[model samples]
Target: MELSVVVVNYNVRYFLEQCLVSVFAAIKGIEGEVWVVDNASTDGSVEMVKLKFPQVKLISNQTNLGFSKANNQAIKLAKGRYTLLLNPDTVVQEDTFRECINFMDTHPDAGGLTVKMIDGKGRYLPESKRGFPSPWASFCKIFGLTSLFPKSKLFAHYYLGHLDKNATHEIEIMPGAFMFLRSEVLKQVGLLDEQFFMYGEDIDLSYRILQHGYKNYYYPKCQIIHYKGESTKKGSLNYVIVFYKAMILFAQKHFSKQKQNHFVTMIKLAVAIRATASIIKRLIIKVWLPVTDFALMFLGAYLLIPWWEQFRHGVTNIYPRDILYALIGFYLLTWIMSLWLYGAYDKPQNLKSGAKGILYGTIAILVVYSILPQNFRFSRAIILILSAWSSLSITLNRILASTFIEGLLKWNARKKSVCFIGTASELKGSEELLIQAGFHRNNITHLLPEEVLDEHQRAKKEIIADAIKYKNISEIIFGTEGIPMTSIIHAMMYLSEFDIDFKIALHGGDSIVGSSSVEAQGELYTLEVIPLAKPVARRQKRIFDILSSALIIVLFPILWIFLVKPLMVFKSALQVFKGEKTWIGYNHPNISKQNSVLKPSVYLYSKWGKGLTSTVGLDFYYAQHFSITLEVSELIRNIFKTQD
Candidate 1:
């Protein structure tokens, strides 16, 4: 056999499926067999492999056998002249396998090879061609000298800076994502050292290949897309700990005790320095908005309100600085925490998320305020004004920043560019929905009617691939209505060459389901991340309803004479305040005959608390959107319309 492809999979079933699709297409002319060794994935990957690609061999492990050990399991049984260790989260181009095989066939000296690779975002991974991570190289990498001086051979040598990324060259390390090996060399140098679990085994194998008198080449004639493993988070303490321990293990196994001690010291110092920087950067990013808002609130409050004053020497006792500090800290923490609970920073950094974050944050702060002691309390009115102003400021800041980055800096304001491919009927109204859903205005879309994309006479994959190539579309969304799943998957396989994204638009409203590039759990779709999906209910939904209702009950009683008509109109709303009914919904208890029609906004949804008034069936729009501002607007309109 020419090749034996070994893919070690752990839970990334969708990615694995796509990778296999690409791999099958890649190894067309070669005599090859694919082996999938699953590490006990509960994501139906085993079934998918068994059902979809029946020809391929599969090894099922009950527990997670780490990458090195899993690959060795297949290596022991591999029959091909060459064994290819491949990551499940990768897509090989059609030429990738052929070129690598041809290169190895020509170069008798080359025992191991890795081709050029890019991430899902199309960024060339420097890890694709790296130095041996010698003490100096590792130092440069950990301290970010590699990025700081990318062109300088000394500082940037960790990524082999002197060599061009597009050129084939001798390299010391090969990423486990795509390690092509000669079977004879593997037998000589031995299988990957299983002692070093996941991260360092590749390094150990690469180093041992050289010790056994073989050269490893970074062949750039072909390229593949690797979604890049993300087991450890960057700049996290756990990342530093896990990764450094791996480094120490490598040093102890290979280097002298004195060198190992030095390596350990270097690793510790680097981890400490980098982790501290990571923490500070995170804190600055997280607290900047709340801190600024706090400052503005303090300024606004001091300017607007004044307590009793003493005329002696024209001076009054100032509010204690310690108390003011305490108040500011309390408010800042509450507001920031509330925004976090509201998912303000989820992604696509838009008006709606910010508006909703502040709205939910305000409600949270109110809850906190009610629970605080009299001595801790300050201006509630100022807080209300602060919430409104903060929302406006935060939104304005995001708009300006996004505009500057997109317009001036020529960066996409939002990273994911979507292509809405739909049937003619589905296309008519979806563009506006997608645009409003935070996709760039210039996003490409294709309308191939059912007749055009019929199974018997389906549009060629070349046509779809060309469109994707031209638009540089990052995400492909199929209208789930008329399009068959087989066609969708077929089209996906055809255009799988690009390091891009895929999603499916649900039929009814604006909801779209898609795969997550960040996670190994495949084919999981969440409205929280995808702005195109329906608005998610706030975590503070019940609290806001209950609190808003209580305030209305208290204030309405005092102003009942003036608000007689409103009170009569708000009788149902009053019931909401009393907890007898909800602040928004579809069902009415008493008024079964007169079903008043309420116009739809994004926020109207049946699952939400019943409001004072809404159009008939309008509450079901929670399936589309739900926002505090949208709710308030409808409530005002409903009240005034009753008088009319």
Candidate 2:
């Protein structure tokens, strides 16, 4: 046997399928066998492998065995001269295997090799070539000296930034996304250390290869698209802890005690710094709009209060000092909280939502005024005028921020001018899928191939370049029907400098997969609908839960008369208030809770004597089309069945 490709897969079902499609295409004529060790993926990955790629050797683990242990399981069974550890989120070119094999055959002392890798966006990944993480390298990396001084050998040794990316060179370490090794070298260095579970094992193995008198090469002749962090989210706090802990473990195993201590301290410091930065970033993203809105609203109300006092009563000091400030604060808080409940602060800013929320809040303020003592009843004119001012101001702010200011800032703007490159049939199929995935038809531009082309491939490349340059295309989709993986790969490589997002539409597949940037996780544009998972839907749902639960508890005296078990109703409301349960959730046995975004609930909509098959069907419908009104109606209908 010449090559054995082992891919460790997690819950990236669609990415895994596309990767396997490319893998089989790459290994078409080679004497190679493929192995996929699935780590308890619940996303139908094992089933996909079994059904789609039957020739692949499969190892279905009952639980997550982590990366190293899973790869070791496959390596022990691999029967070939070269064992290639491939990530399931990567797509290889058709000639990638042949080129790597030829290079490996020529280099007698090369124990390990890795090809150049790009992210889903077609941007070159600097992790393709890296120096060993020594104490100085770690210091440089943790403090971001590597990024600032990328080509400086002293400051940027972490990624070996001074090296030419297009040329092959011997490197100290290889990325775990694509590590090719001679089986003989594996026998000498042993398998990946199980101690370093996921992040640092590749470095540990690379260091061991060097210790065993073999060279590690970074061969740039072959390139693959590594959709980074498909198996796990890299920006998450858990990822930070696990990755740095692995680094500390490597230091402990390899360095002296003093050096290990220094490295451990630096790792801890890096973790602390990252954790702080992550928290600050999250707070800024989640709270900035609300905070800014509140500040502006408060300022507006402050100005309105003084002017209203003078204009309405012909006196500035007529109202009580304490009551005036307190009531204004209360009013502003109520209005902003109502806006949040109505999803006004949601992304793609909804002006109608803001207007609606403020209208409800004004009605609420009028109701409170009617019930309050006569002494505390301020001017109704003031309240009415403030309501109009608040609504207009909020709408104008959101309009300017989302439409004009955010455009100038280029903050999370939607991509435009989408183009698809492929055969006629594949282009049509991809267009259908793109529309089904919710992309606007008007935004997509179908730039047809030049009909008078002599050399079709070269023409296609020129078409892509012209589309990017002239049309200012923000996104490009490559269809795999008539285009070879090599053509797609070369097009991406040659046009890597353009500011465009690249996605691959598998031939006859239902999804298109890509990442917008290096830091982003692999994103798939699919027809799957989970309304409750959207940010606006989730926030509104939680607000409904809180308000409904509070209302239930407050009106318990009257509500108890309609309930079979009144205390159970009270307890369920309390549970919902504490976020222990939702008001309505899926109850079908066949419908997995993991597949839905809702929590366990006190009430179920699909429990109306439906059979086994229809129970799941109803649950699916409920999950996809859930609303606060649906929950309210269901709760009212099932008022006497609270014990269930």
Candidate 3:
């Protein structure tokens, strides 16, 4: 074979499927065989390969072997000149394989080549190439000095910022997204070091290739879209611990003795410093600032009253300089107290927005100024100006600080991953809700159960084992409804063994309390209520009649008064014109002791004329009282009923 692609998959079945599909579609004419080494995926990953692409070779493990060992297992069976370690979450363009193969074929000195990888949203991933992590590089990266001094050559050397993305060049390390390696280079350097498990293995392998006098090229001629963090995007604490532990192992393997010791010492010192800083911050926020503000306010009142009294008569009593000094001292004291009381120096995370900060600060100043002795004749104008300045200053300070703090928090939090557990439908619902609520989809991993002889018991065990194995499930939610109580209990009990925290769906009549509940299909939960205190019948008719009449009057006032009335009059006149007479009359009849009904009656008279002759005849009928009003009332009532 000319090339062999090794993909190590673990519980990313859907992404893996898409990846394989893209690879096969892209490499149709390329000379290669695709090998998938599945690390015991319980999400039908192995079955998918068997059913859909039987021609491809698959190695299914009984348990999840780490990434390096799994890939090595496939590498042992590969018979190719070059071996490409590809992530299952990545999609290759049609030219990717051909381009990489051609590059390596032309450049005999190159040991490995990596293509430019864009994420799903078409943003370039910066981790494509990096300098080897030496003691200085590690320190710069850990302390965020590289980002702080991004344009400085000495500081950004680790990130290789000098290298342009549009050009191919030799680099110390390439990400494992699409690492195309020469089989001969691997034979000389040995397979990937499995001791580091997931993360550091790729770095170790790339460094080893460079150490053996082979160049690693960052080839941008071809491209692949990396979904990024598909496998390890959950269980923040576990991910951190595992990743750092792997880094330590890598450090032990590669770093010089002195550098290694210094790195370890630096890490320990950093932790201690962080803890002390946190304690100091708490003390200042909780105790020192509040006590200091109280003291300053008292001093301001004591000194301000005497000074103000001395200058109460006129500025001539004291020198101009003395009066100015007193005014400045009083203003400084007020400013200090206001700043402290408003939590100006508090942690950025605790800071409120401009409006809230101003509101609180204003209230504090008002109380402080009011309770001071009446002898202190403070100028109202000075107080107003200082208060406005203080509000603006404090609010702007908080806004700037919060922006910086939030950015840092988000950057640090991005490395974390979370695993979700539930059926497909339940997980989809949960995912939609979480996405709407601002949780990134890349951080979510679904833990699915495998088929077994005893499905219920096996499912419970599988879920528990997956949680333990992945060790990154920050929160487990039972999203499925109508699950047996026993199953729920089993799941909860299983999760509790790992000291995992979880939430369950809230059912009928059950209050969620601290938990959140999302709206489900066909499930109605009242969010608000509008009380219909009065009888629905009367309220509906009155509202309808008022609204309808108002709209009609506004839209057609002239038509109602002139055109409609004149039409009726013309009809009456036309009867006279035709030699027939008509009369419009009203009659009142008492229906009950308190109620009377009015009815309108029309009578027609037959006429005799030159062209038309008619005998005198009359038809009389009593119109039903309350008929129009009753019809209108019924229509309004039905409208309200339909709305309900």
| Candidate topping TM-score | 2
lDDT of 2 by residue, 243-351 (tens): 9999999999999999999999989999999988988866776776677777877778778878888887787877787887787787888898888877776654445
> For candidate 1, lDDT tens digit of each residue in 79-158?
99999999987777666788888899999999899988765444567888878878888988887889999877899888
Estimated TM-score per prediction? 0.63, 0.81, 0.45
> Which ten residues in a row are the worst by lDDT in model 3?
524-533
Residue-level lDDT of model 3, residues 170-267, one tens digit each, is 99887877889999999999998989778878889999999999999998777665667666652233554566567678878888888778876765
lDDT of each: 0.67, 0.81, 0.57
Of candidates 2 and 1, the better by TM-score: 2
| Candidate 2: residue 218 Cα off by (Å) | 1.0
Winner by lDDT:
2
Q: Judging by lDDT, tell me the better candidate of 2 and 3.
A: 2
